[model samples]
Target: MEALDFAAESLDAIWSEGAIYNIGFERGVSEWRRFIKPDGILAVSELTWLTERRPADLDTHWREHYVEVDTASAKLALLERQGYAPLGYFVLPRRCWLDGYYRPLQQRFAAFLQAHGNSPAAEAIVEERRHEIELYERYGQYFGYGFYIARKCHYG
Candidate 1:
């Protein structure tokens, strides 16, 4: 995907949510750093390991799905390495999974299946999602969307 080539040292901050992985955590933070003014903030939410150790299945799942998935400390260190000073961090709440995303998505499954003609492919996709939700429900303590907020350490 094409990245926006913003004017250097023009922005006060850059915020990204659940999307930076489209390019990659390191690449996104590094490339975007040049656009921020002195001490400007860079905030992003990324798939992160809540703990260094996790169950084999959960570990395997994330590794397979997002190879860049790592602990929050690692993410923060990566930010620091990219010239950002850590300011704050938090995991997206459980409701962000249940009440916000999965519940709403589950509500659409039937219609989605219907629209897709209930084909095996569509069903398989739904099943995979269900499996993911189940895994989260069981091992949420090990992984989640980690919100990282930091400021640029370099001045223009």
Candidate 2:
């Protein structure tokens, strides 16, 4: 069965961390809103611009990779438009990336590279991950993951 086969308004809460970006933030919110009970909550974490004026290089990189990335206010506006009442939101700390994700990934990538030294595909994948980490190190101050918490409006 497809994903939507689940009954509507059957869930008390819906939480989507990093995965929502895969479906596009606006679309994800719009689609998932139907699955929640009127008073249910939706908590999502998405990439957001932290500063009003971003450096050109960082802006260019995200525009190329994730064109939909926007400021937290913009995301809140979208939530409001989609019938969600904002409760609270916070920017994830840098440690969430460096400590929780990238560092462990770097260790794994190093092991994978050693095990597959002969594979060009493996090298390319490692290189891409390295580049992402490097970009985060340099431009982390301008943007980050934002956790948004909201309650579904009764009318929606």
Candidate 3:
């Protein structure tokens, strides 16, 4: 894999939206912290549990897929442990998931299938996304993307 290279404490802010899962939440913040100046900002939109309790299926699916999926309170505490001061946080609204994201993605499925020649693999990908949307429709109240805004502490 390629690497991230930056001078230590050079950045005034780091912002990541719906993409930090590639490195995992804790690892993303920890690894990137050294690249941010003291008092620099770190803003990220991360998958988060909206409620403390979840159905077995929901919990199992997330833990198996993204181990760091956690409640917003726990995520905030994690920021504290990572040398950042929690500035603000909120879960993206349900409409953000349905109207803004999944709907738009669904709209592209037919063209994607056409471009891919309607291969089994392409169909499977579409099915997977459909399944994901169904799960959200059923269990939306339990989890969502939590947008977190923080500032690197003056002293770690």
The TM-scores of all predictions, comma-separated, are 0.92, 0.92, 0.93
Q: Kindly list the per-residue Cα lDDT of model 3 for residues 1-156, writing each as its tens digit.
A: 026888999999999999999989999999989999999999999999999998999899889888999999999999999999999999999999999999999999999999999999999999989888988999999999999999999753
lDDT of 2 by residue, 51-94 (tens): 88988988888888888899999999999999999999999999
How many residue pairs clash in all the candidates, one count each? 0, 0, 0
- What lDDT does each candidate get? 0.92, 0.90, 0.93
Error of 3 at 33 (Å): 0.4
Distance from true location, Cα of 62 in model 2, Å: 1.1
**lDDT digits (tens) for residues 1-156 of candidate 1:** 246868999999999998999998999999999899988999999999999889999999988988999999999999989999999999999999789888898899999999999999999999989999999999988988999999999745
Worst 10 residues of 3 by lDDT: 1-10
Report lDDT (Cα) of residue 28, candidate 1: 91
- On lDDT, the leading prediction is 3
Off by over 4 Å in 3: none
Which residue pairs in model 3 clash with each other?
none
Better of 1 and 3 by lDDT: 3
